[model samples]
Target: MAEGRSVSDMDVDDVIAMFPKIDPFLIRKWHYAFYTFFDLIGNNVIEWKDFQSLIDAIGAVRGEGSEDHVAAKVSLTKVWKSMTDTMKKDVEDEVKSTSSWKLHVHSSKPCDNRKTEKVLF
Candidate 1:
């Protein structure tokens, strides 16, 4: 399931199915938001690496002390500041709506000879 395609060629529903607990609506919303925010439509799909990049970026801010984390946070902060008011509001609203959501990040541990990383939400 992890091979044979570039990250931008991954199917949305397939990725969503990987995390059963997260609200599909929320995932879909973020999918579209990321799509727009990252300008990922050139290939018409969001790949696994893209999703991992998002998680890493968020984790850099949310995770504890590390030089890499600090650097990622600084980069994200600059991008966040550069975002338009509407874009910021959209993100704020999405976050507010999912404030009560249960999200969990799982490592890409190998299982059955395959590596699957899950960011549950």
Candidate 2:
């Protein structure tokens, strides 16, 4: 791990060295996904505020107070809750660093088609 830098800040070789058991392709994919989806504020970590911003953006497009907006909020809230619960922490204190997020991704078995199908369904 690079001093004062998260895994997201590291190069491919650094990430591979940090997590040798994980696939390099998966790590690269995650690195892309993390920046593209999770890091809404351009920060290296994923926090509740980022999810709230996403929820707000979706609500704005769907129309706040509308059924679709409400449903989106509920669904996103559940997702946030699931993440925090998995880490055994409160929502306000929850912060998904690159290493922790990658570990969670690995534990979720992203390579398993059955699990992926279940999530998609």
Candidate 3:
């Protein structure tokens, strides 16, 4: 995490293992940080893969059923819902401009509710 920490001088697992020996609280903190980072990267990667597969399938749209359309639309919604308001509009704009994947556009408008809005992303 330090500036100019050479990759060759580091082994992430080794630093992570040092947590328990250093402090129990430090271990927990390390775990929380790592898990959050891991989950973020994992989710991004998964969604990217999902979009890639969906795009690959788009070429065979002749075999696509109504459910396929619904699923694609829902995927768009799920992805957009995961972003912030500023990014949400950017995504929606991109979706509108991308002619090839117009079939996957979602209708869910990001809302600014008075309650129950938590920062999931």
Which candidate would rank higher by lDDT, 1 or 3?
Answer: 1
For lDDT, the strongest prediction is 2
Cα error, candidate 2, residue 62 (Å): 2.3
**Mind giving the per-residue lDDT tens digits that candidate 2 earns over 1-121?**
5558665567766766778898988777776776777678767787888778888888899888789888878987876776666556688874577666666667764454334323323
In order of TM-score, best first, we have 2, 1, 3
Tens-place lDDT per residue, model 1, 82-113, is: 33221233423322111111121122124411
Clashes of each: 2, 0, 0
Q: Top model by TM-score, which number?
A: 2
Candidate 3 lDDT over residue span 9-93, tens digit each: 5344444443324444443443343234222333322233444455446535834555665576576456544532423444433
* Residue 121 miss distance in model 1 (angstroms): 16
| TM-score between model 1 and native | 0.33
Q: Lowest-lDDT window of 10 residues in candidate 1?
A: 112-121
Local distance difference test scores for all models: 0.42, 0.70, 0.36
Q: Comparing 2 and 3 by lDDT, which wins? A: 2
